[model samples]
Target chain A: MSINEKDELLYNMENRDVETPQPRVKRGGVHRPFLFGFATALCLVYLMDLGFEAYKFATLRETVQVASGELQTSWPPPPPYTEVARVARYVVHISDWASLATISTAAPIKGFPFANTASVSDGPVGLSSGTPYFYISNLDFTGKDLLTDARTTVSLSEAQSDYCHTSGFDPEDPRCARILLSGSIVEVKNGTEEATFARTALFSRHPVMKTWPIGHHFFFAKLNISHIYVLDFFGGASDVSVQDYYKATPFP
Target chain B: MSINEKDELLYNMENRDVETPQPRVKRGGVHRPFLFGFATALCLVYLMDLGFEAYKFATLRETVQVASGELQTSWPPPPPYTEVARVARYVVHISDWASLATISTAAPIKGFPFANTASVSDGPVGLSSGTPYFYISNLDFTGKDLLTDARTTVSLSEAQSDYCHTSGFDPEDPRCARILLSGSIVEVKNGTEEATFARTALFSRHPVMKTWPIGHHFFFAKLNISHIYVLDFFGGASDVSVQDYYKATPFP
Candidate 1:
C-alpha cells in the first residue's frame, strides 16, 4: 500500500472498536478485539517515536565530537601574567589612620616577647630633619611590653563612632588620631656616639623628647622591620617600600 | 601650668627665629624646636588614629571569628531524594523526530563511526491520532545525512513563515508545523518484533512517533538525545501526560 493508504488504515483502526467473532461472546468476557487494536495502535505510535528520538540523539553526539576535535587543534597559548596583575589592583580600598609596630631584641637575649609602647614614625633617617617621632613614658604598660618584644604590627584606619553621645562628644566631631609603636626599649648609653646621634634626631623631631628630663636613660630599640603591616581602610601593603618607611630606615 | 598656658609658650617659641648665641651655643639646630613641636603634634594625632583603627580591626576580627565558628557548627547535611521528586512533573521539551541507530561494527570509527538513518515525526513524543504522515524519504540528503550518522537533532518550534519557507515548505498551510531535527546516524537495524517493542515504547510517549510508520523494514538508528530543544507553535503535546506510562510494558 502507498504510505497514505497505510496511514489511513492505521487511523481507521485506531478509531474503530475491534470486531468480535461470529459467535457472540459473553457480555463480561474480555473486550479482546478492542484491547488488541488499542495495543497495536499504541505499539505502532511508540515505535515511530523511538525512531525519531534515536535520530536526534545520534545527531547531537556527532556535533559534539566534531566541535571537540576542532577545539583540540587550535593555537597560541593563553597569556598568564595579565590575569594576575588584574586581580592584584582590584583589591585596594582607603579610609584613614594607622598604627605600626616592629620587633626589637637586646644583645644578650634572643626572641624577646612583644612590647606595646614605643614611638613609631615615618620620618628622616637617623637624626635627620623631617623625622617622625613617638613619645611614651617608661612606666607605661606598652613601653614595658615593647621592652620584651621588638617585632610588632601597626594598624591604620578610622575609629567607629557608635558611642559619641554617651562619651559626651558630638558624633560629627573628629576624634584624636592614635599611633602605637610597639617594640623593645633600648637605652641610648651616655657615650655611644651612634646612639647619641639617634637620640639627638629623636629629640629634634619631638618636642616631648627634649623635655622628658635629663639623665633619664633613652634606650634605642632596634626595630625588626620585616613583621610590619601598614593596614589602612585600604588593604595592607605587602611590598617593601611601605615597610621601609614605617621602619624609618632604607633597609631593615 | 595649665595645658593652654603651655600651648601659648610653645606658639611664641615656634614664631621666633634662631640667632647667633653669645656665651654658650644652643645644643640643637635652628629648626629643631619647630620640628620637635610639629612632630609631637603629628605623633599625638597619629597615635590616636592608630588606637581607633586597632579597635575597629579587633571588633571586625571578633565578629568574623564568631560567624565562621557558627557556620562550621551549623551546616546542614545532604537532603533526601524526596525533595527532588516534588518538582518532577515539569515538562521538558523533546524534538519532533528522534532517530535511532545501531552502531555498525564494520566501519572504522574515528570520532563517531556509526552509520544510521534519520526519521521525522509530526510532534514531540509521536504523531497524534488524526495527523497525516509526511513522506520524508532517505533519498533527501538531509534525510540521508541523518541516516549516515544516526546522531541527529531536530527542533519543532514556532517560527516566522519565512523560516518555514526557507526549509522548502509552505508555512501558510495549517497542516505545516516547524520541524527541524539534526543528528548523526548510529545504526540501522532490520524490522523485528523486539525492535518493534522497543520502538513502541520510545514513540508512544513521544508526540512525534504517531505520524511515522511502524512494522516496516526500515532503518532504525540511534538518536542523539542530549541537547534536544523544541519550540511548539501549534501547542502540540501540551495536554499529553509526561508520566513514564510505558515503563513496565513495551508499549504505552
Candidate 2:
C-alpha cells in the first residue's frame, strides 16, 4: 500500500469509529476491511446454507428439488405502494425486463394475445423517464408482431424485482404491486431526439443490445403511456394517470 | 415406542444404508432428528446470509438496492432447453404463479392489452396436464378483462424459477427460457371433470387460494392452449405444438 493509504488505514483502525462522521471523500477508502469481512461472512453463511439444502435434498424423494430463486437485484429503492405514480415509475426504472403482450400477426393466431418476454428500459441509468423502450429485430417474432400490430402493452411485476421477494409477498398477491403500460408501441422516429434517448436508454440497461447483429434490422420501439394500470393494493386495479406516471420521480 | 417402530429406526440409523432403499410403507416416520438438524442448519445459514445482505445495504449509497430474489423452488428437475415441450411443461409446473395478460374492458383503456399477475396451476399435484388454470374474482380486473376477451396469454419465465439463478443466467438471457401460451381463456364449467382437476391443481400448489374471499365472485379459468412459443435456446424462439407440449411430461 502507498504510504498515505497505509497511514490512513492505520489511523482508521486505531479509531475503529463509524461515528467519526468523516467527509464523504475520506469515507470511500475507510472501513473497507469491515466491509470485506462482512461480505465474506455472508458468503460463507450462504454457502453453508446451500450445503444444508443439498443434504436435505439427498434425503427427500428422488425428485429435483428446485433451489430458492431470488430475483436479480438492481439499483433504486421502491416507492411505497400507496404512491401509485411513484411506484409505477420505480418498477419501470429498476426492472430491465418485462413481458410485452402484443396482438398476434400470424395466420390462425391473428387477434390472439401474444405475450413475449422482452428486455426494457424507461431511460438512461440514473435518469428514468417512466417510458418503456425496446430494441427489436425483424428476425425476432416480437418485432414481427410489433410491425403488424403496433398496439401493445408492456407489463412489469414486482416479481421481476427484489421488492416482492424480500418483503415475502407472493408475486400473485395484489399487494405485491404490478404495472402495465398500454398504448401503441410505435418506433421512435429515426433521427429524432426521442430515438436517440431511447437508444441510450435501452443500450445502457441492456448492454448486449449494443453488440447485437446489425444485419438483423434493429429498431427502437417505445410504449407511449396513453394508459396505465397500477395494481398496488388489495382493492383491485386502479387507474394511474399517464401524467402522474411520467411525472413521478423514481430517484427521489 | 412400539417394537416395530423402534426396530425400524434402529435398523435405519445403524445401517445408514441408503442403497437398499425400501418401499413407501416404511416411509411414514424415520430419521427425524437428522432431518431436523439438516433443516435447522440450513435455516441458520440462510438467516446469516440474509443478515449479511442487510449489512451490505447499510454501507452502500442510500438507493433502493433490490434484494437478490430467489424463486420458490419445487421438485422433478427441469428439462433440457433442447426439449421445448418438456422444458415448457417443467417451467409451468414448477412456477406456482405467472403474469396473465388479457384485453381490458374498462371504458378508458378498453381494448388495450392489460396484464395482471396471477396464481395458476396446470393439473393436480402429480397429474400435470400442461394446461394453466386460474382462480379469479369477478370483483377484480382480471376476471372482468377475461369476460370481455377470453383471448389471453399466460406468460411463464424460468426467471420466476430457481433454475435460471442457479445456472447463473440472466432472466433476459435466452438460455434462461421463457414460454408464452397464446389462446382463449375460458371458465372451467363447475362440476365438470376438468373443473375438478383444475381445482385440485390450483389448490394443491397455491393452498392459500382456497381461503380467498368467497364474496369476490371467484371462479376458475383455464387457457385453451392454441399456440405455444418456447424461447429456451440462443438462436431464437421456436414454436411448440400444443399436442407436444401436453404430451411431454415434466417428470421425464
lDDT of candidate 1 over B95-122, digit per residue (tens): 1211122222222211221111122322
lDDT of 1 at B38: 43
Candidate 2 structure quality by residue, lDDT tens digits, B4-70: 9999999888787575656522234533333444455556667877899998755432211212122
Candidate 2 clash pair list: A64-B76, A69-B70, A69-B71, A70-B69, A70-B70, A70-B71, A71-B69, A71-B70, A76-B64, A77-B64
**Count of clashing pairs, candidate 2:** 10
Model 1, residue A146: C-alpha shift (Å):
3.0
DockQ scores for all predicted structures: 0.01, 0.16
* True-structure lDDT of candidate 2: 0.73
Error of 2 at A155 (Å): 1.0
Leading candidate by TM-score: 2
- Model 2 C-alpha lDDT per residue in residues A23-84, reported as the tens digit of each score: 53223553433344445555667787799999875544232121112234346456667888
| Superposition error at A154 for model 1 (Å) | 4.0
